[model samples]
Target: MDVIYVIDILGTFAFAISGALVASKKEFDLFGVIILAFVTAVGGGMLRDILINSHPINWIGDLNYIYTILTAVVCTFLFKSKIAPLRKTFFLFDTIGISVFTLLGLQKGLSLNLPAIVAIIMGMVSAVFGGVIRDVLSREVPLIFKKEIYASACLTGGLIYLLMKQIGVNENVNFIISAIVIITIRTVSVIYKLQLPKIKDDIFTRNQ
Candidate 1:
């Protein structure tokens, strides 16, 4: 199998686990957890593929994606107690998922001859919209809408990958560098509590 394919499967697993954990936290039953896991694993890719008019979507064309998500849900349930106390587990998996999904989505867009900007948007959508769906379902504010840099990291990585590809960077090197840049930026921002500057609360208050 292609290394990218392997990474994509792993990313799907990670996203599913993150979803399952969140569902558990929300006191969801088994069916709800499974549904959430499936959604979080492939919802973004499905949306992206639909937008691009890609036939069969992604998970539809690949049984491995479905299997991986089901396995992740099982593992999450089996080990929830052991892993639940690790507050950082969800963040770790989420960061990894976005990093892989972003590049894969960007690659797909480019393969379809999309514009760089559109490809970047596709990458961002693939990386975060699943989580957006998860958060919306769980009645929590999505991380991308928060002050922290979430989707921004994916967009930055997508842009960097496109720039390097245009300049003829080695494919493996470009992928590695872009993924690292995304993971590093996300980790550092969260660790240091860095955030994009927000409009002051008074602005909204004045509007009201």
Candidate 2:
């Protein structure tokens, strides 16, 4: 398989496993797990494809995406106990997934010869809508709105990817650089507890 396809499949698996783990935490039944896993693996890609008129959606054309999710579910079930250290593993995978999807989305938009702003939006949609669906289904606040620097990180990375591509950088190297930029930003922010400013409670109260 091509490297791009391999990366895409890996990203799909990681996202699906993350979704299933979340469902398990919520005490969801097997059916719920399957639904969440499927949506989380493909929802963002589907939304991106739709927005770009890219067609029939990816998983619909290839069973690989579905099988990837199924494999993730099975692996998660078997290795749940051994996967504790995988909290960080999953986070890294999620970051990689975000990067890959962002690149994929931007590539699609650029293929359509879209404007840069529209291409970035496509990238964000491809990277984020899956998590949005997961949150809605799990009855938790979505990460994008939780001030965790989630989709914004992807947007920033995607923009950088475009700029690098514009400078005639090779596509493969560009992807790695973009992914590292995103992962580094997210890791440092979380590690240092860096976040956007919050309205002080005193200020809000005085205003009211």
Candidate 3:
């Protein structure tokens, strides 16, 4: 199997687990948990493929994706107590998911001859939209909109990937480097409590 394919599957599993963790935190029942997991695993990819007119969609054409999601949900369910305490584990998986999805989406857009800017946007969408959906479903503020360094990391990684490609880097090396850059950025941001500046309350009040 291709390395990208493997990365895609791993990303699916990671996102599924992340979603399941959220569902469990919200005390959702089994069915709701599985549904959230499935959505979080494929929602972004589905949107991306639809936007690009990729035929059949990804999960629709691949049973393995479904199996991977189900497996992640099951594992999360069975080990909720143990896993819930391990916040770092969930963060790690979520970081991996975003990194892989960003690269995969960027490559897909490029393959379809999209403009560089559009491809970068696609990469950001693929990396962050699933979590947005998950957070919306969970009735929480989405991290991407809340001054977090989530989508920015993906954008940075995508740009690095493009720059590397332009400079004649090997495809696999570029992929690895991009993913590493994203993962490292996210990890450091989280660990160090780094965040973007938020709009001050006075800015909104002044208009009113």
Candidate 4:
């Protein structure tokens, strides 16, 4: 199997587990957990593919995606107590998921002959939109909307990947370096409680 394909599958599983974790926190039943898992695993990818006009979609053409999601959901449900306490582990998987998806989306966009700016946006969308959907479903504010450096990490990584590519870096090496950059940024931001400054609500209501 291609390395990118493998990374994509692993990323899917990671996202699925992340979604299941959130569902468990919300005390969702089995069906709801599975639904959330599936959506979180493929929601962003599906949207990205749709935007790019990829035929048959991604997960729809690959049954492995479904199986991967089911496995993640089952494991999460069975080990909810043990897994819930492992916040770091969950964060690690989530970071990996976003990192891999970002690269995949960027590559896909480039392959479609999209401009670098559009590709970068696609990468960011692929990395975070699933979590956005998941949060909306869970009735919580989306992480991207929060002060945390979530989508920005993906955007940073995507830019680095493009730069490395332009400089003739090996594809695999570029992917590894870019993914590490994203993961490190996210980890450090969480540890340091780093966040983007929020706009004051008064600014929006000033004219009103």
Estimate the Cα RMSD of every predicted model relative to the unseen true structure.
3.0, 2.8, 3.0, 3.2
Candidate 2, clashing residue pairs?
none
Model 1 error, position 27 (Å): 1.8
Native-to-model Cα distance after best TM-score fit, residue 161 in candidate 3, in Å: 0.7
**Model 4 lDDT tens row, 143-192:** 67977898889999999999999999998899999999999998899899
- Clashes counted in candidate 3 amount to 0
TM-score of each: 0.90, 0.89, 0.90, 0.89
lDDT of 2 by residue, 1-208 (tens): 2876787888898899988888889999888998899889899988888877887787888998989999988887888777657788888778777888888888888888999989989988888899898999898898778678777788899889989988999988998899888888878888887777666687768788
lDDT leader: 1
lDDT of 1 by residue, 1-208 (tens): 2876777787888889888988998999999999899888899999999999998999899889999999999898888787678658667767876888999999999999999899999999998899889888889998779778888999999999999999999999999999999999999989998888777687768789
CA lDDT scores, all candidates in order: 0.89, 0.85, 0.88, 0.88
Instruction: Give per-residue CA lDDT, model 3, range 12-91, as digits (tens).
Output: 88889888988988999999898889889998888889898987887898889999999998888788687768777667
Each prediction's total of clashing residue pairs, residues at least 3 apart in sequence or on different chains, is 0, 0, 0, 0
The whole-model C-alpha lDDT of candidate 1 against the native structure comes to: 0.89
